[model samples]
Target: MNQFDTSITFPNGVTLKNRLIMSPMTTLQSYYEGTVTQDEIDYYTRRVKGLGAIITGAANVEPLGKGWQGELSVAEDDKIAQLSKLAHSIQSQGSKAILQIFHAGRMTFPATLSGEQPVSASAVPAEHRDPNTHDAVPRSMTNAEVYATIDAFGDATRRAIQAGFDGVELHGANTYLLQQFFSPHSNRRTDEFGGSIDKRYTFIEKTLESVFAAVDHYADRPFIVGYRFSPEEFTNPGITFEDTGYLVDKLVQTKLDYLHVSLDNYKRVSIADNYKNQTILKYLHRMIDNKKPLIGVGGVRTREDVQNVLGSADLVAVGQQKLVDPDWPLKLANNADDAMINDEFKNAIEYTPLNAPLYDFLVERYGSIPNI
Candidate 1:
């Protein structure tokens, strides 16, 4: 049997049909208030072929967590109906649906929050990717607000259960709220939630506690819980590979169903000088010690690419490639590489499942979508 066709089961006893998973990719297709739109549902439903699971784009746990316009929301009970539609659309097609939940924290803009300043572990500003753009300095989250945000995560988890999702992946990566607390660059608090590395981890530890509690209280069936984190950061005083090792070690000892390492390439090496020899994926796998499945994703497109990533981790996730061709896994299964979308079909409105906004976002980021 082909390597990609192999099945894997999580510690929660949830089995994935294959090794392929659709990474959570934001489509900017949701309603302004973050409600799931029909376009988003159709897009995910069309991508279910031959995949084990699909993790929907990050859904904020609170209104202030909105990072940008058109982000999906699990912030309130009213959004559960639309979220249920998204989960059903993916699960009905034989693929597990996992909702990626998060809080944008300091990564958002004032305009996005209706003039309210973004809040974080501290009043620091995040570094913008675009050198020319200036990031707004955020206010420190009050102790009361900090506890409330943690509770918000718990509420979000309950909403996921009510919406019928198979799991929820905590968005602890991409320098979002979770990462902000873990990052010394953003978290300068002297309280219990900051100062030492272990202290900084308090927020994450507590957040996990809240999430698992929700599962135990509301979920009548097995539900997977995963954590995604960046191995290292580029800013000074940022999280290092050493720091990530500590975090991963602690996470592995928990009831987490899986650990996902976010990267631009699955085989990419650590940005830190001490761990540059081996890929971060292999290092994380070693730290996890096979206690939980490790998902490796970044720029994966072809069969060879998937195999290469699988060598280091238990699962391979497809991001940009899945967007380019929703049948990415299906094409690989059928050995129909030539049938993958080409330039002509890429622009064909009838052939593409992406909504207009998503198409514009893709074109603006990647010069014409590449083959999946």
Candidate 2:
């Protein structure tokens, strides 16, 4: 049997329809104020069909956490009505809707956060999303702010449950706040949230503690929770291969639904001496072997690419390819002919929601997003 055609149940008793999932990709379709727009609803509704689960673009858990212009916001109780619209849009198509939650940390702009200085583990600066404030230096978050962020994550999860989402994926990857705390290069503090590798994971552990507590209290039926992380960093003394393994070990023990390894190429291996030859996905797979399922993503475009990733991971997720072909999984299930697949690109323009930043991003940076 084709691996993609099969269903798998997680330890949480939540079962996916098949082994294909929709990876979260920012559409830039929300209101600048962070409300879910009708266009955004239409955008996701088109892609949610046929996947086992669709993880929505990263939504900020607090006002100061917004990373981009159109990022979705879940920082307050009032957002539930609009969030429910999003949840209904995806789940109505029979696929599980999982909201990915995040705090941008130093990746955000001061203008985005209403004049507040961006907060991080330290007063470090990196390339940010806004060109105007690419050089903005963030302040170190106080201990109270740290705990409040953790609480915000829980409140956001509870909001997800109330909004009718099937699950939530903690956005701990892509150099966001969670990864910032875990990276030695970024987290040079001497506190419990930094310094040692074990201590670096304390924030994530506490965040998950709050998340699972909300899940236990709010979810009436089987709900899934997942965590995504980038494997290693290019910076010196940043998250090393060993550090990633250690973090994954701790994450798997939490008994979340699955662990997602973020990669630019699923087959890309480490250049570091410690992890010589094997692909990073395979390296991480070994660490979580028999412990929990892993979701692999990267340059998965065609059926061949899909199967290649599934070989390394329990399930395969698509981001750029999903933009090119929203109905790709459904077409594969029917064994649709090449003519149908080729016609997909022509229809893709309709599926890809139009937003100025998303349009420019597709055209400029990721010229790989096919027909835009």
Candidate 3:
């Protein structure tokens, strides 16, 4: 490998060809039952030709836990077989395969969950409105239900490993299930799972412990475990960089293999805040020590940005940038001059009202659309 080569070797001896990971994007492309289709396999395999590991779209663990209408799921035994096939397709190209496991919490729409209200740590609704429908109120998860959800996450991890995934990523960021527990604005519970900082962290601690135990017992290979966390919650009274640093300290002591850091939970900001801006990446680099591998994701678009962060962090996650060009990592690694993105990819990266119409047409014909 060259000196500037981005390939990284995980603890389990899986060698990533490059440090560019395809971050999970909820593209509403899977079937209603969340089965991976042939088109889905082809979409992911095309991206794996020149990337490191392909982190799959967030796979919901429970049906009621799903956040969107067409979100993917690995909650059932039958789904595992198709997911295994998806993993095999990526592995055939010599790329590691990992799945992002998530529960959308208050972010879930009632229509998505069969008219059942979405659940969260408390009765707090997501600060933002649903893209499809304008609703504010969301249901809350009971203490016992929270515990059950934690177990569900562990079960999902076991299922992912059984399906031949190299590892699983706990979706702790983006104001989802774990983020709902961590944010004071979202988690209003006064019980042990809420209140003080330590109390709020209890859910994540327990979830991580359960997931690690599940992998230990069920996974045939030494599965890699990691969490995607917000370096700074952008809402008022939300988690700050310092709070995330403390969380990182606790997580580093666990069996986690990497930390995927990003910014989320904003009440008011442009869509760019959710995707662009390199400031968050710099802050994340400053917050974390050199203990575990740190993966940074934001508006990173160029090779120079990749190299700058690579000097400090272990990996650079390309989200919208890769949506335009599946060969992004290869182009950067080879130092191509005309690697600038085109209009199509740029438009796809941004949120457009027409996306829904286009997606509806694609799903009708393809049976599923590939979430970037």
Candidate 4:
């Protein structure tokens, strides 16, 4: 079987029809009230194309976990109705619906989370502005609050299953709550949840345990479970290659269906001492020991880029490519390489399913949209 087009089964017996996956990228397209909007539903439906699975934008696990004003929510029973619509819409197009569950942590603002000061593993304020809110001063999370948040992850998992999602990917990357705990630059606690390297991992470990507990009880089908993480952080006391190696080894022993590595470039070499010149994806593929699937993502825009990423990891995820052209993988499957991406941004309003908010955000962030 051609690797990218082959069907493979997970440890839990769930099989993805193909290897192409749509990575989760935040699209502030939901209703302000936290319900899924018709535009958001149509957005995902149009993006499925030929992808085997679609990791929907991160959904908040608690009221205080909201990262942006229009992000999807899985925090309550009432949300299941909209979540169900989302799951069915994606699945109806033959894509497995994997909800990316998350808590924004220090990345959120007090105003977004109902006036609660953003909380993190420690009181260390974020070095940069909170991207969405522009600025946010965060506080430390109490020990009890920590456990409560962990339980909230489990609650979110239950909600995902109840809403008929095929699986849930824990949002551990991108400076969220999970990353905040794992990052030395952010986690400075003297308690069991911080300080030593092993202690810092406690938060991720415990949170996964809680989430897995929910899956064990609620997921009667072969539901896939995955973790997304960034290999390194740029801070002074950041997450290093060694730290990621340790974490990868631990993940291999778990029930995780896959480990998704988030990177800006799939082949960018590391400057870390022992692993200088080695790409992060290559390092992780080795550490995983073929015990589980590894998804490599970042700047994968073409068929050749996807092929290069597939050379190291089990699957390739496209974020910006999806923004530019939602039918990326579908075109590739039809051997339509030249037609894979929409090169006409000016005509995006004519052919793109993107909501106005997302279209504006893309042009603002990327500086230029395709001339379509």
Top candidate (lDDT): 1
lDDT of 3 by residue, 334-357 (tens): 788386564554354444222453
lDDT of 2 by residue, 1-372 (tens): 239878989888988889899898887878887888888888788888788889999999999899988889898888899999999999887788999999999887778787788899888776433435544788899999999999999999999999999899999998999999999877878888988888888999999999999999988988789999999888776788888889988998895999998888887888679787788987888889869899999877777877888777899988876776777777877877362344343345445555666666666544464422
Model 2 scores a TM of 0.92
Better of 1 and 3 by TM-score: 1
Candidate order by decreasing lDDT: 1, 4, 2, 3
> How well does candidate 1 score on lDDT at residue 345?
31
Taken over the whole model, the C-alpha lDDT of each candidate is: 0.89, 0.84, 0.75, 0.85
Regions of candidate 1 where Cα sits further than 4 Å from its true position? 129-135, 341-353, 367-372
Model 2 C-alpha lDDT versus the unseen true structure: 0.84
Q: Summarize candidate 4's per-residue lDDT along 56-172 as a digit string, tens digits.
A: 999999988888888898988999988999999999978799999999999877778777788889877777665344345678899999999999999999999999999999999
Q: Candidate 4 at 139: error in angstroms? A: 1.0
Window of ten residues with lowest summed lDDT in model 3: 263-272
TM-score of each: 0.94, 0.92, 0.86, 0.94
Worst 10 residues of 1 by lDDT: 342-351
- lDDT for residue 161 in candidate 3, whole number 0-100: 89
lDDT of 1 by residue, 1-372 (tens): 227798988999999999899998878989999999999999898889899999989999999999988999999999999999999999987889999999999989889999888899998888754434445788899999999999999999999999999999999999999999999999999999999999999999999999999999999999999999989999999999999989998999999999999998877888778787788887888788788889999878777788889888899888877776888788899999887664443454345656789877766655554432
